[model samples]
Each structure stands twice: as C-alpha cells, then as structure tokens.
Target: MKVFLAIAAKVRGTGVERAMAVARRSIGAAFPVPAEEVTHEEWREPGAALLAWTNEPGPAITYAAGVSGYLADPRDLPAAAAGDLGLGGCYSLFTCRSAATGPTGADPVYHAETPELHVYGSRALLVHLVATGGRVEHDPLALQSMVRQGYFLSDETPFAGVRALPPGHRITAGRAEPYGLAEPTDLASALVASVRGIEGTARLTLTGGRDSRLIAATLHAAGIPFTAVTYGTQDNPDVILARKVARRLRVDHQVIAPKPVTPDDTATRVAEVLRTCEGMTSAYENVAPHTPFRARPSLGGHGGEILRGGFLLGCQDHRRKLDALFLGNLDLLTAEAAEHARGLAESWQPTPETLDHLYLRYRVGRWHAAARAGIQRSGLRIQPFLDHRVVTAALAVDPAERATQGLVHGLIAELAPALARVPFEARRWPWSKPAQKTPDWRSEPGDALKSAILGSRELAAIVRLDRVEPLLYGPRLPKPALVWHLATVATLLRPMRMAVAA
Candidate 1:
C-alpha cells in the first residue's frame, strides 16, 4: 500500500516547512516503512510540498492513490487530462488549478482538499491533523448518519471540517465543477482497455452473480490471463457457480474457504479496518477471509449495479417518495441526522434519470468508494465498471431494459455466450440468513474493541450510554451489523481523542 500527504501553502510566512515535517511524522507513524522508500518533493514559489511513500520500487507519486499511473510533476495538476491516470479504479488525486494556485482535480473516492492542504491518503489525513496540533472534532450529524445508514450522507465525514470528494466532480480553487464523462461508443472494447491498464497481476473475485460473471466473460473475450478466486465453502452457491464459469473460460480457479480467527486476532482485524477506512463506513467483518489477492491487484464487479437499476428499483418516480424509500428509515438516526438526510434527499432533482444517477452518486460514489479505500490498504482493486467510459455507457442504457439485469445479461452474452449460459445466484433484500444461535451483544465485543470504546470520552459524548443499557449497554443494536458499525466509529475516534487528550 502507498501513503502520502501533499500540502500547498501560498502564503509566504505560513510555516510550510514545519507543516510538512509534522505531516511526515504523522504519515510515518501509520506506514512505518523504510525511510529510503519515501519520496519527498518541494516547490518554493507556491510553497508546495509532497511526501509519498510506497513499499514498491521507483520514486512514488503521492499525487494519486488507489490507481496505477504516472505523475510527471506536481505543477502539472492544473493542466492534467482526466485520462492521464487509467480508468476504472478507486483513487484520490491532487491537481493544481494554475501555476500560482493550490492543487485541484476530480474527486476519485476517499480524498480531502482544503484551501492550502490536500490529502490523498485515507486515514493519513486524520493522522496528519493529530500530529499538526489541529482540532479533531467529531461531526454529530455524520456520526449519526454512519450509525443509522452504515455510511455518511452527502460529503460529510465523521470528522468535522473534512469532506470526502463526491465521485465524478472536480474541486478547483475550493469550488466544485462537473467533469462530465462521455458514453463509450464500444462498451466491450472499453472494458478490455480498462483491464489492460492494470500494472501487475490481476485476479477476478468470481462469484455467482451477474456483475462478476460479466467481468469474467470480458476478461476471457480479451484473452487476458487472470485467475478466478472464490471465497466460501465448496457447497456455497457462489463457489459452485464460480467454478463452472472458470471451467467454461478455461482459466485457473482457486477457492479460499473462510477460517475461524482467534479472539485476539479478531480484535486486531477490527482495529485495522477502522483505521484503514477512516471511519467513513461500517466495519462488519471482524475476521476478513484470508486470500492471495491481498498482495496482488484484485478485479471486482463494483459499480455494475448501476447498469441494472438495482438501487431502490420499485420506488415511485417522485423525489419525496424516493426519499421515503431510501432515507426514511430513521429508527437509528438522531433528530439532526434525520433532518440532514431529508435535506439531501430533497436536493436531488426528480428527473427521469434520478434513480440511476442518485445511486451512482451516493451509493457507488460515496459508500462503495469508502469501502474500496479500506480494502485497497491491504491490496489494490480494479473496478472496470467504475471506469468513466463504462459508467457513461451504463447511464445511457434504457432503464426499462436494465430493470431485470437485461443490460448485464446482454453484455455477458455478447462477450462470451457460453459463460452467460451458466446460472447465477440471486437473493432478496436482507441478504444474510439468521444465525443458528443468536449471540449476546455484550459478550460479542472483541477485547481490543471493547477496551477502546469503553475508555473513550469522545464516543460517550455522541452516544447516550444510559438510555440503551439493556440493549448491550449502549448505541442502538438492532442487529449485528449495527453493533459492528458502532464499534468502527469508536475505534476510529480512539486515536484522535488520545492525541487531543495528550
């Protein structure tokens, strides 16, 4: 994984050097790699500086994270073409608006850009703030939104004054502008090109689903050499179907079954996930399945659901009705959070394309973007469906045609008719089945997570510990997912609160 911090201070006496030093210390604490592997660059006139560190070879380009690309110089930001970096991967990049101005560019996924400082690394931003002696206050609305909806609404983060850039938009001179994507003339060719852009080995997380199957077909059609890896027991439908797909394509197939983790390791995994994701999303899986993809770039089928119109499919075509459908579940939200969610819902224009665009912007851009950021900390993931060309093609498809995954099926058949012939798994809402025996929430908290949450004053301030005493002694726990979500929030706030208290 690569970690970096970029700062652009235009003022002459703003202590730019001191700021960079603090940033380096912060980033070092998180990465802890050899000093020689870190690359440092500076500019005098505009008072710009960048510190990029990677475990791999060559001078690191900290300008962008999560995507493989080249950066000629820090000053090229203002004139950077969108395609300068390859398509269909999660990333955060810093581009300058002009020779004399701060850096600006399109928001890839998890990035924060202020007037003078632009941070490309996810949790590195939080670490920098603590090291620089800046205030690290929590955003109540954002915290509530995370607990209620498993993600922050709009552009807000759990931390005050920090905003994750919405995908497909660019920030220049601290202002946002639309960087439009044109629909691809040839969708299959675009998919092929996107996969070919990856630098090293790539593996597809093959599953018994329309999205992954479509990607598998494209890889085979293009003659791309890649492995299809599945996680779960052999009896699982995903594994069973994935094996058939790989056999049809005649590609190497591997399956990694889930293994139990010791209690100590479970705690450690939870903490790592919280820090990596920077508390922008939930931390449901305490013991992530081990896999070979952690060290290699993995190809995933993210953002493909947009082509199928999978978000709020049956809801009425009205803004308020859509709001009620998506944002009305306020059982866990605070009063302020409910209001903010409603405001965001009402802000959308009720055009014919509202459903698809809304999902693309919020669900894929914000939620999935954060999730991918966390996953990339361990390994790189290339999402071909998220490429600008593919997104444009998806948006241009007729909604009625995609209502039942018609677009996905047609694309797969066009790419490889034999692979499309295999049946895939489909489930209704609330995907997970009930556990054989429900475990008590009080006993389920891992040691590290329990200690971190119980000792934090920051979490106590946001959540009322007295009201829900019977319900695991704190924060609303309607289900196991909510429990993990609250634990993630606590773990993320722990380090920031510790730094402040010290």
Candidate 2:
C-alpha cells in the first residue's frame, strides 16, 4: 500500500488557488483521470474539516493535500477514521500556510504559519508536508532517520539536532574552510583513489558532458579498467558520444534504452529497493528501473557542478535573457510562494545582490526540501561533485576563471587532449555540438554479456515514482505537475539513497 499526504491552505490572492488548479489539471492530464469521477467524501464541523478520496479500495494509492492548519490539528477523530478505514497505502503529507504569515509561538497551534516542507514515506504511507508561514519544530527521531538515509538537503546549514550516520554512513565533510588555491593534480589523484578504492568490477557512467568524461579519462590514464554506461532512446547524443569515448579507450561501453514502466511495478520495485538499502524510497524511482546493470563498485560523474563553480555560472551567462523570462513568469507563481521562497533565501544568509543566490536559496531550496525526503530512501552511495579534489581545486580558482571559464570538459581537454576526443552529450553541455558520435553502441556484441555480469536484482527493484500516479498526486491533483514532481523527486532520492545504502 502506498499513500501521500499534503497540507494545503487558501492564499490571500488567487495564487494558491491558481497554482493548485494548474497543478491539479496538470496531474489530471498526465494521469488521464476525470475529476468528478474521483470518489470523494467531505466532512465539516466546528474547528474541524475533512475530505477523503480513494479509488479501488484494497491496497490502493491515496494522497492527502491539506492546509497547514489542517495538518497541525488533523482532528484525532479523522486521523483515527483514516487508520480504521485504511485510507492510504503510500502517504505524502504537505504542511501549508500563507507566505504573508510569520511564525508566532503564540499563534494557533493548528493554524500557525510555517516555512518547512516535510515528506516521509513507507510501504503503507507517504507524507508530504510544507510549513508555509512559520518554521516547524524538528522531530529528532525523524531528522536522524532522514540524515542516516541521506534524505536531507541544504548545503548552507545543517538541520538542528540532526547528525550524519555513524562510521560508514559518514563521509568526512573533509576540509572545513574552502581551500584558497586550485589543486587539480591533487584532486585528480584523490578522485582516482576514490574510484580505485571501490572493490569488484567498477563502471563509470560516461556522458558527452565533461564531468563523467573527465572522470573516465582520468581512470583511463591511471590504467584502471572501467565499463562505461549511457542511456537514451535510439540514437541519443549521449549514446553516440559515450561509444566514441569507449572506442577510443578500448573499454567496454553499454547503452540503456528507456522503457515505459507501469505503476504497480514501480511501487513494488521501489519498496524492495528501499528495503534492501534500508533507506527511504524517493522520486528517482525510475533510475533504478532504468539501470542497465546492477550494483557493483562503481563511480559516477557527480562533482562537475562544484568543479565548474556551480550553476551560477550559467545563470550569469544568460542573466539578461533570464531576467526577462523571470519577469514574464513572475505572475505564474503565487505571491505567497514567492514570498516563502524569499524568506527562505533570507534565512539562508544569501546576498540580496546575487540573483543566482536568490534563485538557488529560494526556488531550488523549496524544490529540494520537498524532494529530499525521497532521495534519502534509495540508499545508494553518492559521490557528489563536492567530494572530488579536482572540484575543490576548481573551486579554489579565481571566481572569474572558475565561473563559465569553460566547461569542465574543456579543462579535461586541456589536461588530456587524446581523452578529450571522447564524446558526451547532456542537455546542459557548454558546447553546441554533441560530445562524441559513434556506431550504434546499444547493439554492440558484448553489451548484453556485460549487463548480465554487472546488473543487480536489488538495484532493478527501485521504482520510478513518476510512473506511479497515485504516489504523486491526490485524487484532486493535476496530472502534469504530478509527473514533473515525480520525476524530480526520483532523481534526488535515487542517487542519495543508493549512496547511503551502499
């Protein structure tokens, strides 16, 4: 059984209503379910109001989208009724309040405004809650569990009372303050060492993009053998470029074709993967589903962002155009949502002048907060861009040189011209052309054999939440937004979960 819960509130203006309406319509379109056809019941009483909806009674998916006040109170009788009725399978709880509101200790306990969004999930329930007007008090046990599982996000500050897992679960925060100078040579060695430390057959997910390619080239130069993996539908640019790199290196390369997955299968797979990893199941449900091969000692191209000076570089490059675009869409988001994002940015100590900081601190933070709950679930080992010494060195470079100086791939190209010839493609590639082009790699003779040797049944069981409708939206949610949210959540959760689980 999977259930989702959310707490929603009526905004002062039409922003909340409009956003909700858009979200609901989007979810409906994606899921293709009629609103009126949805089975529903509503309850109204003094100091309490309730609405419940379900489809296909037994072991069915249910989601609750509630207002912050509603979530704070959650009328005991109604909660009991839900439990008695077995109302939700996988639950998502959303805690919502108005952005205009501020937290007051003296405010109504049930209706106080909050700024945090908390989401939790289990086989039987999924909780998604957002604190709209105030900050919700952290629950120690919940926070600990989330951290151990790698579900929490926010690089600026640690959540109060939460600690990273002991021993294996802990990745040394490493050097405390940022190193002042760039040390690519040392960083590269560390990156290589990290990959070499992994026992068994190691694979690198090569992209035409510079990050993975740099990692791949480094490994190649180090004389470490690695099988490269790529994914896409037929003739995808990444597939083409990865093959070129593999051919140049004379290493095994595999391309995974995307497959349409069903909801039940996704749910079942995610639950199994989470159990195996002993972590929370998150939105990156599809990642596990699409994995061509299983778990092994492996390396991924993750630290590219930090090495390249973060997404701010790109945002800066197109600031003028983006400003225009943002102005156009400003009305699309609720004022409260905007205000919530602003308040969050301020709390994070972001400089008002840095537009990029504002965007990340507010927009990205909100989305990550909502999605981090899921990432903590997959339990996969993740070596983020922040972990690599090369990245650290890159960060140490003058901000002018580090920011949009060039693609990290370009830097790798400078280091190893021969390896740079290998092609990779990502939507965000700095270059206009695809990374590398080659003969169809998916049909290569040894691809299937390699998959058989490296794939894991456990990894395969991780579900793609985007494929599961009920987990994403309540009976009332819009389909498109549900799909978007599902995909976003899956990506965040799967990698983190895999990292922690390993």
Candidate 3:
C-alpha cells in the first residue's frame, strides 16, 4: 500500500516530529500492510515537510491541476525528487489541490488539501490535532449523525474542534465551487478522457449496477483494455451479470469470493474494516476477506447515480424531505450535538431543484469518500463519474431524461450496443439461490458480539450500555447493522483515545 503523512509547521521542531511519528504509527497499525517510511523531506517553511512511504512506485501526493495550470507546480513546492514524491508520472490519485499553514493558533497548524476522493479529509485530521497539541474528544453531533445515518453530513467528523473540509472546497479560499475538468463533450467522452489520463491501465470494479455498467461500456468503446473485477459468490446477480457483461466486451473478468470467517478472527477483521472505512460505514456489510488488487490504477463508478437522479428520486420539497431523513434520534444527543443536528440542512444549503447536485456534495462527497479511502488501501483508485466534466454535463441534462435514466441508457447504447443487450440486474429473481451473506457475530459460536461492545469503555460512554448489554444475549437481539455502526465508531476512537490518554 502507498501512503504518506505530511506536516506543515511554523518551525521545524520536536512537536512536528512527534506529530509525524504518531500519524505514521496510527496509519501503519490499522492497515494490513506495514507502511515503511521511505521518503522524508523538509520544505522552505522552517518546519514544513512531506513524509511518504510505499510498496508501490510513486508517492501518494502529486501536483494538482488547479487555477495555476496542468502539472504546473503552482506554489513551487520543493523541487527535490525522492523515491516516489517527485518521480512524477500521472500522480492524479491523491493530487495536492492547495495548502496553507497559519496565522498561528496556540501554535502553527499544518494544512494539506488534496482533491482526493473517498477520504473527504478525516485522514489528515489527526495531524491537525497532534501538530497543535490539541485535545481529542468525541463530537456528540458527529456521534448522533453516525448513529442515525452511518456517516456524517456536510463537513462533520467524529472529533470535536476537527472537521473534514467540505466537499469540492478549495482550502485557501473556503469556496465549494464545481470542479471543472477542461471540457469533454458528454459523459462518455469525459469518462474516456479521464481514464486515458491515468498513467496505466485502469481496474474497473464491475457490478450489476447501472453505474459500473456504463463505465464498462465506455471503456469498451474507447478500445481501452481493462480488467473487470467483481466481488461476490457465483449466485450473486452482480457476479453473474458482471461475467456476462465482460464476455460481451471480450475483456478479462475476475471474481473475488466472499469467505465466512471464524469467531476468533472476527474482532480483528472488524477493526481493520473500521480503520479502512474511517468508521463511517458498517463492518457487518463488509466482513468478507479482501485481497489487495495488484498495484494498478482502480476505477470506481461513484457519484454516477447522482448524475442520473438516482439519489434525488422522490422529493420535490428538498428542505422538508432532507430534514425528515437526516434529523431525528435527538433524544440521546447532547445540547451541542442537537444544535449541530438541526443545522445540517442549513450547512448543505438544500433547495428543491438543486437537490441532485447537493446530494453529490453531501452524500457522495462525505459518505462515498470514506468508502473510496478504504478501497485505495488496495492501490490507487479513481472515480470517473465524479470527473468534473461529466458531472457538469450530467447536471445539464433535462430532469425528465435523467429520472428515466435517459442519459445513462443512451450513452450505453452509443458506447457498446452489445452491453445493452444484457438487461441490468435491478433485483435477483425470486427463485435464484441467495448469495452468500456474512454471518453476524451472534451467529458465530462464541461471545464475539458481547466482547466487542461490552469491552469498549469508549463505546459504552457514547451508547447506553444498559440498552446494548441485555440484547447481546437476546431472546431478541440488537440490530446487526446498529451494532456494526457502534463497533466501527468505537474502533476509530480507540487509537485517538489512547493518544489522548498518553
């Protein structure tokens, strides 16, 4: 896995060193592969530096295409070339969009803003807190949001005094402007161009969904050879239809099976998934064993559905609908958390017509960002649908056309007619054998579920233990989904708690 931890400080000293050390240890311990520090350098600002480690060829950071120009070092960052930092091929995966450090707060703060997908900015929150010697504490509103929706809305995170940069916001200006991608004709053209821009062949995560199918069709039309990878059992419609789609295109297809785990490894695996997801998603939904992709650029269809109005289907009244959906479960919230929960809709700036665009920034930007980060641990990952040009074009299409998936259907027909021949798998057939599902901890023969929740003092403090404890032995059990959400949030907080305690 290729990863980096960079700090920008007012002056180079012991604090910066301590911050970097903590970040490296925190990141290294959570992932499957150990992150060895391979490249470290100090920049012009007395203490500013970028430290990187990788098993891959390039650094995770790259020069971003921004107001400056394509590939131009806008800020003239250090010209030093190390193992992967400056060797530059197309380092688009985690490109640095903008960076700035302080007018001094208690001490200097290090800010590195990258236009990367899936992570939003939680990965860098640790550095921000540690560099300033800031205390770490659970943010109640963030906890409430996580409990209700599995992830935060707007820029909320699970930590107080620390917030993720809002989606598509420029760090220096604090603006949420639409990301522009030069200009490509339509969705297909924009996707093809983006994929072509990657340094190597892209690995497509093919599924039965319309989003991935559109990507597959576009790649086939462009004559780009890409491997289609599916994750699920043979009985899974996604696996079945993905195979059909791959065969029609005559491209290589690979399926990764879902394996059931023993009770002994359940806790360990759950913690790893928690670290990967940043605790924004449930580990129960993703308990399958995952093998990292062979070091290659991976392409995902994230944010595509939003383009076709999949996220904004039924609600004409955006304000009323969004509030009803996100704002609830306030009984357990602290006063501050309750206030923050009430403010979510305002932060999103939702309106009836622009709801689709808002969902992109709200859901895709925040929740999808975490999922994308988890996948990147496998290798470099990119989402073509979120490409600025495609998003711009998709948003421009008539609402009626998008609602009926007119844009997506037409593009698939144009790109690869053969693909359109195979019907999209919206739902499995009534008689189709059920795909293998990951067993819940209760099903595992042991005290896995009880140990996980009861053992976490941090979790007990946030969630009422009395409510969760009795359900563990249940004649009636706690919802598996809720338990997963609780466990994940607790796992994320554990390391930070230990750091705070130390």
What is each predicted model's overall lDDT from 0 to 1? 0.57, 0.35, 0.53
Q: Give lDDT tens digits, candidate 2, residues 103-164.
A: 11000111111222221111111111122111112222221212212332222112222221
Query: What TM-score quantifies how close candidate 2 is to the native fold?
Result: 0.43
Task: Tell me the spans in candidate 1 whose CA falls farther than 4 Å from its real position.
Answer: 29-45, 62-90, 96-135, 198-201, 261-269, 285-296, 313-334, 349-352, 426-457, 460-467, 473-478, 494-502
Per-model TM-score versus the true fold = 0.78, 0.43, 0.74
List model 3 lDDT by residue over 169-222, tens digit each: 334322323233233356667666655555557789999988899988877776
Worst 10 residues of 3 by lDDT: 100-109
lDDT of 1 by residue, 1-502 (tens): 4554445554544555666666655554454334554555433335555455555444444233222222222333333433333234334454323111001111232344554454433343443463344545566666765665666656677666666555555554345555555444577777766566554456999888988898888777777778999987776778888999999988889999866543445455565655555566676743233232244657767667776774545655556656544474554444555676677666677654676666676677556655554454445556677665566656667765676777788889989988767887833225555433434443464445455555656556555544323334345344556556666776667645424222
How close to the true structure is residue 281 of candidate 2, measured as C-alpha lDDT? Answer: 28
User: Which structure among the candidates has the greatest lDDT?
Assistant: 1
What RMSD, rounded to one decimal, does every model reach?
A: 5.7, 19.4, 7.1
lDDT of 1: 0.57
Look at candidate 3 and give me any clashing residue pairs. Answer: 12-47, 59-84, 118-369
